[model samples]
Target: MRVGDVFLKVDADQARIEVEAMALAPVPTPKVLWRKPPVLAIAAVPGTALGRLGEPSTASPAAWAAAGAAIRKLHDAPLPPWPGRGLDELAADLDGECEWLVTNGVLPADLVTRNRQVAEAALRPWTPVFTHGTDVDLDVIRAWSSLRSLLGVRWLVEHGFDPTAPGCEVDVLRSRM
Candidate 1:
Protein backbone atom coordinates (compact mmCIF):
# COMPACT_ATOMS: atom_id res chain seq x y z
CA MET A 1 0.00 0.00 0.00
CA ARG A 2 1.16 3.51 -0.72
CA VAL A 3 1.97 5.36 2.47
CA GLY A 4 0.30 8.72 2.51
CA ASP A 5 2.40 11.85 2.68
CA VAL A 6 0.72 12.73 5.91
CA PHE A 7 2.85 12.01 8.96
CA LEU A 8 1.60 11.83 12.51
CA LYS A 9 3.83 12.67 15.44
CA VAL A 10 2.84 10.60 18.42
CA ASP A 11 4.58 8.91 21.28
CA ALA A 12 6.59 5.83 20.21
CA ASP A 13 4.70 3.52 22.53
CA GLN A 14 1.35 4.88 21.37
CA ALA A 15 2.38 4.59 17.73
CA ARG A 16 3.32 0.98 18.34
CA ILE A 17 -0.02 0.31 19.98
CA GLU A 18 -1.86 2.03 17.09
CA VAL A 19 0.03 -0.04 14.53
CA GLU A 20 -0.68 -3.24 16.41
CA ALA A 21 -4.35 -2.41 16.74
CA MET A 22 -4.62 -1.63 13.05
CA ALA A 23 -2.95 -4.92 12.20
CA LEU A 24 -5.40 -6.87 14.33
CA ALA A 25 -8.51 -5.16 12.97
CA PRO A 26 -10.60 -7.28 10.59
CA VAL A 27 -11.87 -4.13 8.90
CA PRO A 28 -9.75 -2.04 6.61
CA THR A 29 -7.17 0.14 8.36
CA PRO A 30 -4.31 2.30 7.28
CA LYS A 31 -1.17 0.34 6.51
CA VAL A 32 1.84 1.13 8.67
CA LEU A 33 4.75 1.98 6.40
CA TRP A 34 7.52 2.86 8.84
CA ARG A 35 8.19 4.13 12.32
CA LYS A 36 10.57 6.63 13.78
CA PRO A 37 10.81 7.40 17.50
CA PRO A 38 7.99 9.95 17.47
CA VAL A 39 6.56 9.79 13.94
CA LEU A 40 4.72 6.92 12.33
CA ALA A 41 4.02 6.74 8.61
CA ILE A 42 0.86 5.01 7.48
CA ALA A 43 -1.07 4.69 4.25
CA ALA A 44 -4.35 6.52 4.10
CA VAL A 45 -7.56 4.53 3.86
CA PRO A 46 -9.37 4.99 0.53
CA GLY A 47 -12.21 7.00 2.03
CA THR A 48 -12.49 9.62 4.69
CA ALA A 49 -13.86 8.44 8.01
CA LEU A 50 -17.57 7.57 7.71
CA GLY A 51 -18.18 10.80 9.57
CA ARG A 52 -16.88 12.74 12.51
CA LEU A 53 -18.66 13.19 15.79
CA GLY A 54 -21.52 15.76 15.70
CA GLU A 55 -21.26 16.10 11.92
CA PRO A 56 -23.79 15.09 9.32
CA SER A 57 -22.62 12.12 7.24
CA THR A 58 -22.48 12.55 3.48
CA ALA A 59 -21.62 8.90 2.90
CA SER A 60 -24.26 6.80 1.21
CA PRO A 61 -26.35 4.11 2.85
CA ALA A 62 -24.17 1.56 1.12
CA ALA A 63 -21.17 2.95 2.99
CA TRP A 64 -23.00 2.60 6.27
CA ALA A 65 -23.88 -1.03 5.49
CA ALA A 66 -20.31 -1.70 4.51
CA ALA A 67 -19.11 -0.24 7.82
CA GLY A 68 -21.61 -2.27 9.77
CA ALA A 69 -20.46 -5.38 7.94
CA ALA A 70 -16.84 -4.55 8.72
CA ILE A 71 -17.58 -3.98 12.40
CA ARG A 72 -19.42 -7.32 12.50
CA LYS A 73 -16.38 -9.00 11.02
CA LEU A 74 -14.11 -7.33 13.56
CA HIS A 75 -16.31 -8.24 16.50
CA ASP A 76 -16.64 -11.82 15.32
CA ALA A 77 -12.89 -12.29 15.03
CA PRO A 78 -10.98 -14.01 17.83
CA LEU A 79 -10.27 -11.98 20.94
CA PRO A 80 -6.91 -10.23 21.14
CA PRO A 81 -4.30 -11.60 23.55
CA TRP A 82 -4.20 -8.52 25.76
CA PRO A 83 -6.31 -8.56 28.88
CA GLY A 84 -6.96 -4.90 28.07
CA ARG A 85 -9.26 -4.38 31.03
CA GLY A 86 -12.09 -6.42 32.44
CA LEU A 87 -15.57 -4.96 32.94
CA ASP A 88 -15.12 -5.19 36.67
CA GLU A 89 -11.91 -3.23 36.47
CA LEU A 90 -13.55 -0.64 34.26
CA ALA A 91 -16.44 -0.34 36.69
CA ALA A 92 -14.05 0.03 39.59
CA ASP A 93 -12.20 2.74 37.75
CA LEU A 94 -15.48 4.54 37.19
CA ASP A 95 -16.34 4.13 40.82
CA GLY A 96 -13.01 5.59 41.86
CA GLU A 97 -13.50 8.55 39.56
CA CYS A 98 -16.98 9.06 40.88
CA GLU A 99 -15.64 8.97 44.42
CA TRP A 100 -13.13 11.61 43.54
CA LEU A 101 -15.79 13.78 41.93
CA VAL A 102 -18.08 13.42 44.90
CA THR A 103 -15.34 14.12 47.41
CA ASN A 104 -14.31 17.24 45.48
CA GLY A 105 -17.94 18.35 45.30
CA VAL A 106 -17.77 18.38 41.53
CA LEU A 107 -20.85 16.19 41.63
CA PRO A 108 -23.29 15.21 44.33
CA ALA A 109 -22.84 11.79 45.92
CA ASP A 110 -26.41 10.81 45.00
CA LEU A 111 -25.80 11.70 41.36
CA VAL A 112 -22.62 9.66 41.29
CA THR A 113 -24.30 6.71 42.95
CA ARG A 114 -27.23 6.83 40.56
CA ASN A 115 -24.96 6.92 37.56
CA ARG A 116 -23.04 3.99 39.00
CA GLN A 117 -26.22 1.99 39.37
CA VAL A 118 -27.18 2.83 35.77
CA ALA A 119 -23.76 1.77 34.61
CA GLU A 120 -24.31 -1.74 35.98
CA ALA A 121 -25.47 -2.71 32.50
CA ALA A 122 -21.87 -2.31 31.39
CA LEU A 123 -20.35 -4.27 34.25
CA ARG A 124 -20.97 -7.77 32.93
CA PRO A 125 -18.31 -10.25 31.82
CA TRP A 126 -17.24 -9.73 28.20
CA THR A 127 -14.60 -11.06 25.87
CA PRO A 128 -12.16 -8.32 24.97
CA VAL A 129 -11.73 -7.53 21.28
CA PHE A 130 -9.04 -5.48 19.64
CA THR A 131 -9.47 -1.75 20.26
CA HIS A 132 -7.39 1.38 19.92
CA GLY A 133 -8.87 2.47 23.29
CA THR A 134 -11.86 4.36 24.60
CA ASP A 135 -11.65 7.51 22.51
CA VAL A 136 -11.09 5.67 19.25
CA ASP A 137 -13.80 3.19 20.06
CA LEU A 138 -16.18 6.01 20.93
CA ASP A 139 -15.52 7.70 17.62
CA VAL A 140 -16.19 4.49 15.73
CA ILE A 141 -19.41 3.97 17.64
CA ARG A 142 -20.46 7.55 17.04
CA ALA A 143 -19.92 7.13 13.32
CA TRP A 144 -21.83 3.89 13.36
CA SER A 145 -24.66 5.39 15.34
CA SER A 146 -24.94 8.36 13.03
CA LEU A 147 -25.14 6.08 10.01
CA ARG A 148 -27.61 3.74 11.64
CA SER A 149 -29.75 6.56 12.94
CA LEU A 150 -29.94 8.08 9.49
CA LEU A 151 -31.10 4.82 7.98
CA GLY A 152 -33.09 3.71 11.01
CA VAL A 153 -33.87 0.18 12.23
CA ARG A 154 -36.28 -0.39 9.36
CA TRP A 155 -33.42 -0.07 6.94
CA LEU A 156 -31.37 -2.57 8.87
CA VAL A 157 -34.27 -5.00 8.96
CA GLU A 158 -34.89 -4.59 5.29
CA HIS A 159 -31.21 -5.09 4.59
CA GLY A 160 -31.16 -8.38 6.57
CA PHE A 161 -29.32 -7.10 9.63
CA ASP A 162 -30.94 -7.90 12.94
CA PRO A 163 -31.25 -4.61 14.71
CA THR A 164 -32.59 -6.24 17.85
CA ALA A 165 -30.49 -9.38 17.67
CA PRO A 166 -27.25 -10.09 19.50
CA GLY A 167 -23.99 -9.98 17.54
CA CYS A 168 -25.30 -7.48 15.03
CA GLU A 169 -23.57 -4.22 14.26
CA VAL A 170 -25.77 -2.51 16.82
CA ASP A 171 -24.47 -4.88 19.49
CA VAL A 172 -20.77 -4.23 18.82
CA LEU A 173 -19.27 -6.60 21.41
CA ARG A 174 -22.31 -6.06 23.65
CA SER A 175 -20.85 -3.12 25.49
CA ARG A 176 -24.31 -2.40 26.89
CA MET A 177 -24.87 -5.96 28.13
Candidate 2:
Protein backbone atom coordinates (compact mmCIF):
# COMPACT_ATOMS: atom_id res chain seq x y z
CA MET A 1 0.00 0.00 0.00
CA ARG A 2 1.16 3.46 -0.80
CA VAL A 3 0.55 6.52 1.30
CA GLY A 4 2.08 9.55 -0.35
CA ASP A 5 5.84 9.04 -0.59
CA VAL A 6 5.91 5.85 1.46
CA PHE A 7 5.08 2.32 0.38
CA LEU A 8 4.01 -0.13 3.04
CA LYS A 9 4.62 -3.79 2.38
CA VAL A 10 2.88 -6.27 4.63
CA ASP A 11 4.02 -9.87 4.60
CA ALA A 12 5.88 -11.53 7.42
CA ASP A 13 7.85 -13.94 5.23
CA GLN A 14 8.51 -11.44 2.44
CA ALA A 15 9.35 -8.55 4.74
CA ARG A 16 12.32 -10.34 6.21
CA ILE A 17 13.56 -11.37 2.77
CA GLU A 18 13.21 -7.82 1.43
CA VAL A 19 15.01 -6.34 4.39
CA GLU A 20 17.91 -8.74 4.14
CA ALA A 21 18.13 -8.46 0.36
CA MET A 22 18.03 -4.65 0.39
CA ALA A 23 20.83 -4.57 2.92
CA LEU A 24 22.98 -6.87 0.80
CA ALA A 25 22.12 -5.65 -2.71
CA PRO A 26 24.73 -3.47 -4.45
CA VAL A 27 22.15 -1.76 -6.67
CA PRO A 28 19.63 0.83 -5.53
CA THR A 29 16.61 -0.32 -3.61
CA PRO A 30 13.88 1.48 -1.75
CA LYS A 31 15.11 3.13 1.45
CA VAL A 32 13.88 1.39 4.58
CA LEU A 33 11.77 3.76 6.67
CA TRP A 34 10.69 1.35 9.39
CA ARG A 35 9.81 -2.31 9.83
CA LYS A 36 7.63 -4.40 12.09
CA PRO A 37 6.53 -8.01 11.79
CA PRO A 38 4.28 -8.36 8.73
CA VAL A 39 4.91 -4.78 7.73
CA LEU A 40 7.82 -2.85 6.21
CA ALA A 41 7.57 0.75 5.21
CA ILE A 42 9.94 2.22 2.64
CA ALA A 43 10.20 5.53 0.91
CA ALA A 44 8.98 5.38 -2.67
CA VAL A 45 11.42 5.55 -5.56
CA PRO A 46 10.95 8.59 -7.77
CA GLY A 47 9.96 7.02 -11.05
CA THR A 48 6.92 5.70 -12.80
CA ALA A 49 6.62 1.95 -13.19
CA LEU A 50 8.61 0.77 -16.22
CA GLY A 51 5.63 -1.23 -17.33
CA ARG A 52 2.68 -3.13 -16.02
CA LEU A 53 2.17 -6.79 -16.66
CA GLY A 54 0.19 -7.64 -19.83
CA GLU A 55 0.83 -4.15 -21.18
CA PRO A 56 3.31 -2.83 -23.68
CA SER A 57 6.26 -1.13 -22.05
CA THR A 58 6.54 2.55 -22.83
CA ALA A 59 9.98 2.88 -21.28
CA SER A 60 12.83 3.97 -23.54
CA PRO A 61 15.49 1.47 -24.67
CA ALA A 62 17.93 3.09 -22.26
CA ALA A 63 15.54 2.43 -19.37
CA TRP A 64 15.28 -1.22 -20.38
CA ALA A 65 19.07 -1.52 -20.69
CA ALA A 66 19.53 0.09 -17.32
CA ALA A 67 17.10 -2.34 -15.77
CA GLY A 68 18.99 -5.23 -17.31
CA ALA A 69 22.28 -3.86 -15.98
CA ALA A 70 20.84 -3.63 -12.49
CA ILE A 71 19.67 -7.24 -12.68
CA ARG A 72 23.14 -8.30 -13.87
CA LYS A 73 24.68 -6.49 -10.92
CA LEU A 74 22.35 -8.25 -8.51
CA HIS A 75 23.21 -11.61 -10.05
CA ASP A 76 26.92 -10.86 -9.63
CA ALA A 77 26.56 -9.87 -5.95
CA PRO A 78 27.51 -12.22 -3.11
CA LEU A 79 25.17 -15.07 -2.34
CA PRO A 80 22.71 -14.43 0.44
CA PRO A 81 23.12 -16.16 3.79
CA TRP A 82 20.02 -18.29 3.17
CA PRO A 83 19.84 -20.94 0.50
CA GLY A 84 17.21 -21.27 -2.19
CA ARG A 85 15.53 -24.43 -3.44
CA GLY A 86 17.58 -27.00 -5.29
CA LEU A 87 16.81 -28.01 -8.89
CA ASP A 88 15.12 -31.27 -7.92
CA GLU A 89 13.02 -29.52 -5.33
CA LEU A 90 11.93 -26.86 -7.78
CA ALA A 91 11.05 -29.53 -10.37
CA ALA A 92 8.99 -31.44 -7.84
CA ASP A 93 7.13 -28.32 -6.84
CA LEU A 94 6.48 -27.43 -10.45
CA ASP A 95 5.19 -30.90 -11.33
CA GLY A 96 3.05 -31.05 -8.21
CA GLU A 97 1.53 -27.65 -8.86
CA CYS A 98 0.88 -28.47 -12.51
CA GLU A 99 -0.89 -31.65 -11.46
CA TRP A 100 -2.97 -29.73 -8.98
CA LEU A 101 -3.92 -27.18 -11.59
CA VAL A 102 -5.09 -29.91 -13.93
CA THR A 103 -6.85 -32.00 -11.27
CA ASN A 104 -8.63 -29.02 -9.78
CA GLY A 105 -9.63 -27.70 -13.21
CA VAL A 106 -7.82 -24.47 -12.39
CA LEU A 107 -6.42 -24.38 -15.90
CA PRO A 108 -6.86 -26.40 -19.06
CA ALA A 109 -4.75 -29.54 -19.27
CA ASP A 110 -3.01 -28.48 -22.48
CA LEU A 111 -2.14 -25.07 -21.06
CA VAL A 112 -0.60 -26.62 -17.99
CA THR A 113 1.23 -29.19 -20.07
CA ARG A 114 2.74 -26.64 -22.40
CA ASN A 115 3.85 -24.41 -19.60
CA ARG A 116 5.26 -27.39 -17.73
CA GLN A 117 7.31 -28.27 -20.79
CA VAL A 118 8.60 -24.71 -20.93
CA ALA A 119 9.32 -24.86 -17.22
CA GLU A 120 11.38 -28.01 -17.63
CA ALA A 121 14.15 -26.05 -19.28
CA ALA A 122 14.73 -24.40 -15.94
CA LEU A 123 15.18 -27.67 -14.07
CA ARG A 124 18.77 -28.03 -15.24
CA PRO A 125 21.53 -27.14 -12.79
CA TRP A 126 22.84 -23.60 -12.65
CA THR A 127 25.02 -21.73 -10.20
CA PRO A 128 23.03 -20.05 -7.47
CA VAL A 129 22.85 -16.28 -7.03
CA PHE A 130 21.25 -13.74 -4.70
CA THR A 131 17.83 -13.90 -6.37
CA HIS A 132 14.49 -13.44 -4.68
CA GLY A 133 13.38 -17.05 -5.21
CA THR A 134 12.93 -17.15 -9.03
CA ASP A 135 15.54 -18.56 -11.39
CA VAL A 136 17.75 -16.30 -13.47
CA ASP A 137 17.26 -18.03 -16.82
CA LEU A 138 14.72 -16.42 -19.16
CA ASP A 139 13.04 -19.78 -19.66
CA VAL A 140 12.84 -20.22 -15.91
CA ILE A 141 11.43 -16.75 -15.51
CA ARG A 142 8.62 -17.53 -17.94
CA ALA A 143 8.08 -20.91 -16.36
CA TRP A 144 7.95 -19.47 -12.88
CA SER A 145 5.42 -16.88 -13.96
CA SER A 146 3.17 -19.62 -15.26
CA LEU A 147 3.61 -21.66 -12.09
CA ARG A 148 2.95 -18.68 -9.86
CA SER A 149 -0.17 -17.80 -11.83
CA LEU A 150 -1.40 -21.37 -11.56
CA LEU A 151 -0.81 -21.34 -7.80
CA GLY A 152 -2.56 -18.02 -7.36
CA VAL A 153 -5.70 -18.67 -9.39
CA ARG A 154 -7.63 -20.26 -6.55
CA TRP A 155 -6.37 -17.80 -3.97
CA LEU A 156 -7.19 -14.86 -6.20
CA VAL A 157 -10.69 -16.19 -6.84
CA GLU A 158 -11.26 -16.83 -3.13
CA HIS A 159 -10.23 -13.29 -2.40
CA GLY A 160 -12.78 -11.90 -4.91
CA PHE A 161 -10.26 -11.33 -7.66
CA ASP A 162 -11.15 -12.18 -11.22
CA PRO A 163 -8.22 -14.10 -12.65
CA THR A 164 -9.53 -13.53 -16.19
CA ALA A 165 -9.41 -9.77 -15.83
CA PRO A 166 -7.32 -7.90 -18.38
CA GLY A 167 -3.60 -7.73 -17.54
CA CYS A 168 -4.03 -10.29 -14.75
CA GLU A 169 -2.05 -13.49 -14.54
CA VAL A 170 -4.40 -15.58 -16.58
CA ASP A 171 -4.45 -13.11 -19.41
CA VAL A 172 -0.69 -12.85 -19.33
CA LEU A 173 -0.34 -16.61 -19.56
CA ARG A 174 -2.77 -16.77 -22.45
CA SER A 175 -0.88 -14.06 -24.26
CA ARG A 176 2.39 -15.94 -23.90
CA MET A 177 0.98 -19.03 -25.55
Q: Total backbone clashes of model 1? A: 0
In candidate 1, the residue pairs with backbone N, CA or C atoms under 3 Å apart (3 or more residues apart, or in different chains) clash, namely: none
> How many residue pairs collide in each prediction?
0, 0
Clashing pairs in 2: none
- Per-residue lDDT of candidate 1, residues 66-109 (tens digit): 87777677766776555554556555655665566567664456
Top-lDDT candidate index: 2
Weakest 10 consecutive residues of candidate 2 by summed lDDT: 8-17
Query: What do the candidate models score in CA lDDT, each in turn?
Result: 0.50, 0.70
Candidate 2 lDDT for residue 17: 38
Quote each prediction's TM-score. Answer: 0.45, 0.69
Task: Return the lDDT, model 2, position 57.
Answer: 88
lDDT of 2 at 176: 58
Cand. 2 TM to true fold: 0.69
Q: Per-prediction RMSD in angstroms?
A: 13.9, 4.7
Query: How well does candidate 2 match the true structure, expressed as C-alpha RMSD?
Result: 4.7
lDDT of 2: 0.70
